[model samples]
Target: MGKSEAQTLLEKADKKANSSGGWFSSSTTKYEEAGDMYQQAGNAFKIDKLFKEAGDAFAREAECREKCKEVNEAANAWWNASKAYKRGYPDLAVQALSQTITALTRAGRFRQAADREKEIAQIHLQETNDLRKACESFERAADWYAQEDATATANACFKDAADLHADLEEYAIAIERYEQVADHSLTSNLTKYSVKDYWLKAGLCALALDVVTAKRNMGKYASQDVTFPSTREAKFINALVEACETGDVEAFTGAVVEFDQVTKLDNWKTNMLLKIKRGIQTESIL
Candidate 1:
């Protein structure tokens, strides 16, 4: 088949780039010109539905800008590459985003790198539907934000990972991440009030596993936060733990009902507790 217009343009751009001192030693204007040609080729490829080629061209444009020390422009070009790859090649999209993140970080743009990390986590969660990968990515993003002293943002990312782990029924991992959220929140005056809620979530996740784990976590929470005091939430968790220890389905239901009457359980918590109740009943039968 004859070369398509996009392919022809890309070949011409490559030849021009090679003749003009190549990628490594090209003048800034020469690199810019090459980058523009590559970008044009990428757009033409997109119109032809040559998605992988489009992505490659955009990535090449990004590389040229990166060599020129145009960090922001390179980051944008990488982002475009990711967008181009998203439709037919999700893994490539992720790779492109990773490059963007590395470029931004190398330029000492920590905040932007943190944001890009979060975007990568979101892509793992929403596009790839890989909960474990999403959790891992979120944890990395949280660490980056924490390094920058963005405690609230870090806590939020940790919470998101914890929630995803909970959905995966990885209760222990969920509990650990939730505790991290609580621990971080307690250290910041602005987020102190939310600590109890995170601890409550951690306690609930532990309760889903076993009463002993829940109790152990309760003690740990008390030790970690000296200000931890008994509240209705604490009482509710304690009651559930006691009921779970005894395999008392009735008592478990009663405790959940009582708590629901006051501070209503969300749908997810309600479903998890109901499943636990069923498990207890089944065990009693056996």
Candidate 2:
């Protein structure tokens, strides 16, 4: 069959599959067939030096196969998306990601979905400065786990949104959200207390807000109690103190770099770092 006939056939198949509403059990066969047709069209397009068309066909095939839970097929779609992204077709990349997200979401693997969503959000933030939209995407992602009452995951989403907001200098909203996570009442979840990892996140957020507020207040609220921050908190505090003491942007940037290297924090590490970050010369618990 000619490439035009094959493309037409594939398009019809895709419309049928879409009408089925992604109910994979009923449409898997149709998707599998459609995917094969798309592949043939994609190959034809590639042979004709139509990389863009080839990518679109491959991406569509991947999306169809992904809905059918064909992991290899889904991965291939992402590979095609990468090719498209490399070819400077961000729209194709976005399409590929959309399919990937659908697969991840349907599989009930929310963490992966959240990660992908963040990746897309980052791209949007970088490419278009659509921070508000990025924030919305993050919120949707957080809501996914939040619906499951996954406090840790939800807190992380909130934290990311707060950071973006901070970047926009929306400090008050950022601080409030940070506090909501940092001061999350685990009074019900005492099991997390013995587990220093959990509270470390809380402590980090608190320390950051305190420091941010201090800077905003020109040291009016600067307290010495920023002791024992989580390892993550320690980095920021260490950076701030070093920045103040040495007046080195490099050292200061390193200290306040936001990503955390430590997954958990020891109580001692958390406390000590928090104190120092808050301008306390020592951990003299008051």
Candidate 3:
């Protein structure tokens, strides 16, 4: 019954939207009615668990609303479409959310756009397995949030982007992002304590490039935050850099093991350490 009703409403909406013969006959009313019909069709389809149909109906509604200059309403309809598509069509979901972001941006709702950016980023990360897209979305989200004066949220998004870049082995980009986060953290007393963590992450990425680069960046990290040099994280970074500099695989492994015993290394850290170890071994063979 619900599916039949939804299909009926969709047909009516399509006819209303497609009816021609305007010439100043005021087609705005027809568009507004068509939008209403589409919204009803979407709701009915959703009640019948026809997600794709629901999403399609909502997208049509959004288009009609946009035609009527109802920007916020159009954005809401696009958001609904994204949610409906998310259960089955992840790529379509991302596309719908992109529409939402565009509408919201045109409406000057930067914060909401930022929220949608993060949502789409997560879908890319967990559903699409597209880390590059996820990283770019996160960076875009950070820009939106920063423009909205949401400093902490922006920094967190940057950190997430940096982590994704690291996961993709794009160490230079990851290091830059980590440094951006650390630079932002340095300006706030509440966040100053976490600066060392970002610095440590940046150092690890630099170490992946080379020991000279790692040592140079670590120097910058210490200069940025005076207390960083005294932290155990800094000591570990120095030790790892030296191990890499000397082409000592055992020393690298020993340093990682010692660090893990203290701070409980995460998967990202472990993976990066493994890469560093391989580089050392490769160099030793040469």
Question: What's the best-to-worst order under lDDT?
Answer: 3, 1, 2
Best candidate according to TM-score = 3
RMSD of model 1, in Å? Answer: 3.8
- Give the poorly placed runs of model 3, Cα more than 4 Å off: 1-3, 20-25
Relative to the true structure, candidate 2 has a C-alpha RMSD (angstroms) of 10.6
lDDT, candidate 2, equals 0.58
Q: Number of backbone collisions per candidate, in order?
A: 0, 12, 0
Candidate 2 lDDT by residue in tens digits, 109-155: 67666766766676666765778877777777777767767777777
lDDT of 1 by residue, 240-265 (tens): 88888898888998999898998888
TM-score of each: 0.80, 0.47, 0.93
Which scores greater on TM-score, model 1 or model 3? 3
Where model 2 places Cα greater than 4 Å from the true spot, the runs are: 1-31, 37-51, 62-83, 99-109, 146-156, 184-286
Q: Give each prediction's root-mean-square deviation over alpha carbons.
A: 3.8, 10.6, 2.1
Output the worst ten-in-a-row residue range by lDDT, candidate 1: 17-26
